[model samples]
Target: MLYQNFSKTPVLAAAATSLLLLLLLSSTAHAEAPMAANEATEVVISASRIEMARESSGSAITVLDSDYLEQNQVQVVSDVLRDVPGVAVSRTGGAGAPTQVRIRGAEANQTLVLIDGIEVNDVASGSEFNFAHLMNLEVERIEVLRGAQSALWGSDAMGGVINIVTKRGKGSLNGKITVEGGSYDTHQETLAINAGTDDYHYALSGTLLNTNGISAASEERGNREKDGYKNATINLKSGIDLLDNLSMDLVVRHVKSDVDTDSFLGGVGAVDSDDNTETEQTSGKVSAKLDLLDEQWHHRLSFSANDTDNTFFTAGTESYNSQGYKQKYEYQTDLFLYSSLTNSDDLEHRFTFAAEHEEEEFYNKGFSTIDRDMDVSGYVVEYGANIDDRYYATVAGRRDINSLFQNANTYRLTFAGWVTDSVRLHTSKGKGIKNPTLFELFGSTPDYTGNADLRPEENSTWDVGTEYHFNALDGYVDLTYFHTDVTNLITGSGQTSVNMPSDAKIKGVELSLVLRPSDNTRLNSSYTYTDSNDGNGNELVRRPEHVASINGSYLFSNDQTRLTTGVQYNGKQDDIEYDANWNTSTVTLSDYTLVNVALTHQLNKHIELFGRVDNLLNEEYEEVLTYGTKGINGMVGITITGSL
Candidate 1:
C-alpha cells in the first residue's frame, strides 16, 4: 500500500528499458583495436575504516575520484553527490543556504559525515552537516557507504557514512591554479601548492567564491530582491616520515561564508522574511601511526576537534546565534592474522580493534548559555577474511556508553562471493543507533521543555545485491534490494520534544549499468525506487518514489579531449504543508529533470581548459516547497598543473 499512487507498471520495467538501450548501443560498435584494460580499482576507507578494494568490501558504496571530479568541473561537494543512488539532497536557496541530505529514506540527522576521518556533524544543529557550506577544495576522493553503519561508525550513522579524503604531496614542486566565471554574476578562484619527497609531504590550498542575482524565495512567491553569497576556504595537509616504522600527520580545514536567506511563512496575505546568515566552521586533526612486528601489526592514535559558530540577522529585533564544539580522542590497531592460508594468493585474514572518547558542548547568543556537556566512550572489534578464491566475509561489533543515556550495542555481518566467473553476489545485515543531540536533550526553554527520559533511536537494516560483468562489452550491471525498520523516532511538537510511539518502515531497489563499447565512448544509467511510511498512513516528507539518471561521454580528436553529458529525473512526491491555523496538509510536488554538459581539452601537459553548464534546460522547479533554485548557470576555467 505504500506505493498506491504509482502506476501499475513495476519500477523495474524502467530499468530494463534503459538497459536495453545500452545493450543496443554496444551491439553496433566494432572496435578497430583491442580495448584497454580496466582501470585499477581505488582503495576506499569508509566501509571498515581500513583501505580495501570496493569489489571485496561486501557493501553498497560509491566513490568519486579526483579525475572524475575534474572531468565534470565540480566545485561544490553537494553537486557531485546529488544524483547518487538512494540519496536525496534539498536546499532552501543558493550555494550558502541550509541543505539537507537523506539516505535510503532516513532522516537528515541519521547520516554521518567525516572529513579525513574526523566527524564533522554539528551537535547543536540536530546532528546534521550543511552540504551547502562544504567546498571540494583539495579533495582527492569521496566515498559514500549506504545503509546502517552504526556497528562501525557509531551514532549518527543509522543511515550511512560519507568520507572525504584530501590530497597530499607526492613529489617535489607541484601546484595548480584555476579561475572561473559564468552566469548570475558568479566567480571563483583557487590556488593549490604541494611539495615534498617520499620522506615528507605537505599541501596547502585556498578558494574564494562570490555569487549574486538570485532571490531566496521562489518567483511564484513574488519575491524581487537579489540574494548574494560569499565563501572563503583554506585547507592544509602535512605529514612527516619520522622514522622507518612511524609517521605523524596533520590536517586542518577552515570555511567562512555568508548568505542572504529566506525564512517565510506562506498563507493568505503572507510576506517573505529576508534575512542575512553567516557561519564559520574550523576543524583540525593530528594522528600518529606506527608499524611493528615486521609490518604484521599497525597502530594509529589521533586527536581531533571541530568548532562552529553561526548567526542569523533579521529585519527586526529577532535574531539568534549558536556555537557548537566537539573533541575526540581515538586509538585503533590492525593485525594480519594470516596472510597466506593456502598455496593460492587469494587467502587472507585481518583483525581490527578500536576505542574512542568524544565530548560535545553548545551555547546560544540571545538566551543564557546552556552550558551543557556530555561525553561518550565507544569500542569496536572487527574481523575480515577472503577464504579460498570465491568468498569474502566481514563481521563487526560496537558498543557505546553515554554519560546521559543508556548503553547501546550494534553489530553487522556481510558476505560477497562469486556464483560464476562473471557473476557475483553480496548481502549484509546490521543494527544502528543514534543518541539525542545536545540541543534536543538540554537546550529547551520554560515553555518548551526537553524530555529528560528520552531514549535513543534504533534500527535494523538488510540488503542483498548482485553484479554481472560482460567481458565482451567491457561493462557491468548491478541490482540491489534493501529494507529498514526504525523505531523511537523523536518528534517536536509545538511545545516539547518527545519520542513518537510510531515506527517507520522503508524499502527500495537500486539499479546501475555501465557499458564501454569502444575506447573512445562510454554509457551509464542508474535508477532507484523507494517506498516508505511513518506508521500514520502518511508518506515520508521529501522522499521521492522514483529517481533515475543517464550519462554518456566521448573522446574526440584525441585522448586529451573529451565531452560528457548527463540528465537526472526526480519523480513526484508528497510533502507536508502547514496552514496559518497550524493545520497540516499533504501536497504533491511536481516531478522535474535536470540536464548538464561539460567539456575538457588539454593544450599540452602543463595547461588545460575546461567548461561546464548546469541546468541546460533551465527547468524552474523547487526542491523545497517555497525555496528558489538556480536556473541556468555555467563556468569556464583554465588549469595549469605539473610535478617536477
Candidate 2:
C-alpha cells in the first residue's frame, strides 16, 4: 500500500532519490579546498536547555533563521514547516483556520510548542497549540527538534518540540515598518523597534492583518459564501543587568483574532453558514539568572503564564465559549565539573539539574459546564561530556509527579562524533509520555463524552543519522532513519474517547541537502519516506507516505535584487469522511503540488520593495476533507528601516 501511494508521484520520488544518491557519491569525492572559515557554528538551545553546538547534539534538529523567513516572505509559521522533513502540516481551511502539525506521524497534541522557553499549548483544546495565529512578524528563528524529548521538556514532548525564539534588542536603536496588500481583500501592516545598551535592552513589535478569505467549505461543493479573518498581535521583550553576575529578563505577548467559519451538515460535510469564532491569547514570562563560582555555576529562576479565551457564534447568536490557563514556576542550575582548557586531560564534563511546578485550568460553557484543573511537578538531571570536541555524549532523566493519573519517568541518551573533518555521525534514543488532557477526561458535549478512565500515552523513539559537508559548495547533506512505538493511543470512538489496546508503529527516512553552487545562488531540498500503521493494521490519517520539497534563491542586479522559488509535493493520504447520517468511511485525498515565488529589490539603504505569489500553479488541493484551499494569490509590500 505504501509503495502504491509513493508510486503516484513517481517524478518527485525519482528526483529526490537521484539527489540523495548524488550527495552520497559526492561525499566520497576529494575536495579541492578546505572548508570556509566564515562558516558560523550553529548553536541549539532547545536540545538541552542550554546552548550547544549543533554538531555536538545527537538529536535530529532543523533551524530556520530570520533571513530565510524574510526571503520566503512567510507570514504563517506553518507555511515554512511544510518544507521540513518528517513534519506534516494540515490546515482545515484557509488562513487563520485551525491548523495542526504532526512530527514523525505522532498525534498533534503530542508535539510540544515553546515560545521563548515558555510552553504555550492550549489546555482547553486537548494540549495542542494552534498555528493559525502564529505569525512570523517578530520571530528571530525557529528550532524543530525531532524524536522523543520528555526527559528534558516533560509531558507533551512525545512527538518532538518546536521552539520559537523572538528577536532581542542589540546595537543601536533601529526599527522597521512594513505594509502589504494582496488578493482576497487582504492587507497587513507591521512595525518593530529594538534598542539596547550595556545595562538594559528592549524589543517591541506589533502586527495587524485582515483578509476576506475563501469559503471554509469547498467551493466546488456548491459553497460560495466567503469566510473572512482578522488578527492583531503585540509582543515585547526586555532585559536589564541587575548586578555584575545577576540579570533579569521579561517577555510578554498578546493576540486577538476573529475568523468566519462554515457549518458541518449531517450528510453534506461542510456547507456555507453564518458562523464565526473569536480568540484572545495572552502570555508572559519573567526570569532572573545568576552566576556563581567564577562563572562555572549558573542558576536561573523563572515564572511563566499563558491564557486563552475562545468564543463561537452561530447565526450571530452565542453558541459556546472556552478558556484555558497555565502557569509554571521553575528553577535550574548548571555546574561545569571539568573543562579541557582548565584540565590537563582532553575531556570536559557538565551537569544540569532542574525542577518545575506547573498548573493548568480549563473551563467551558455550552451544552455542559466543565471546569477542571490539574497540577504536576517534575525534576530533571543530566550529565554531558565532550572529548576533545570530537566525541559527545549525554544522559538525561526526568520524573513527574501528577495530581491525577499515574506518575511517569522518562530518560534519553545521545551520542555524536566526528568521523572526519567533513563527516559526522549522530544518534539518540529516548522515552516520552503525554498525559490525558482535561477536555478528554471531563468535558462533555451533546455529541461527545469524556472518558475519565483514559491513561497517558507512552512513546519510545530512536534515530541515527549522518551529515556530510562539501567543502567545495559550502553546503551539506544529511540523512537519517527514525522509528517510534506508541502505546495506549487515545482516540475517539462512538461518543466518547478511549485508549486503544494495540500499539502503533511509525518509522521513516529523511534526506536533506543544501548547496551554494555559486556565491549568488543557493538551493535547499528535502525528502521524507514514512510508514505509519496502527496496531489494527490501518494507515494513519493525513500522514503522507512520501513528501518532498525544493527551494532556491538567486541574487542579481548588483546584489540588490533577489528571486526565490519553492515547490512542495504531498503524496496521497487517508482521511475520514462522514455522511448526513454520521456514517464514517475512509477516503484517500489526492496528491498535490504547490509552487510559490517571491521577488525583492532593495530600493535604497533604508527602503525595500517586495512582491510574492502563492500557489503560483493554481493547483486544486485539499489538506483536510471538505476544507477549502486558496488558489493563486499575489501580494506586494514595502518595508522601511531606520535608526531612531
- Candidates' C-alpha lDDT: 0.80, 0.87
User: At residue 201, what lDDT does model 1 achieve?
Assistant: 92
lDDT of 1 by residue, 1-644 (tens): 11122233222233244334434543333322211112565578888888877777788887777866766678888876865788888777777878888888888889999988889998767678989888889889998888999999989899999899989887778889988888888999999999978789999999999998478787667976778899999999999989989999999999999888766553421235667878899999999998755555667878888898877788734477777888877777766544446577645566677777777887765444566777777888898887764688999999898888889999988899989989989998999998988777766432245566778989999999999988887877889999999898776654456776888889999898877888888777878899988778778888999988887888896788999888888898777665765445778888999999999998899998989999999999888777788888898888888774
Clashing pairs in model 1, backbone N/Cα/C closer than 3 A: none
For candidate 2, write residues 189-296 as lDDT tens digits: 999999999899999999999999999998977889999999999999999999998999999999999999998765677889999999999999999998765565
Cα miss at 565, model 1 (Å)?
A: 1.0
Candidate 2: lDDT of 437? 93
**Cα deviation of 235, candidate 2, in Å:** 0.6
Best by lDDT: 2
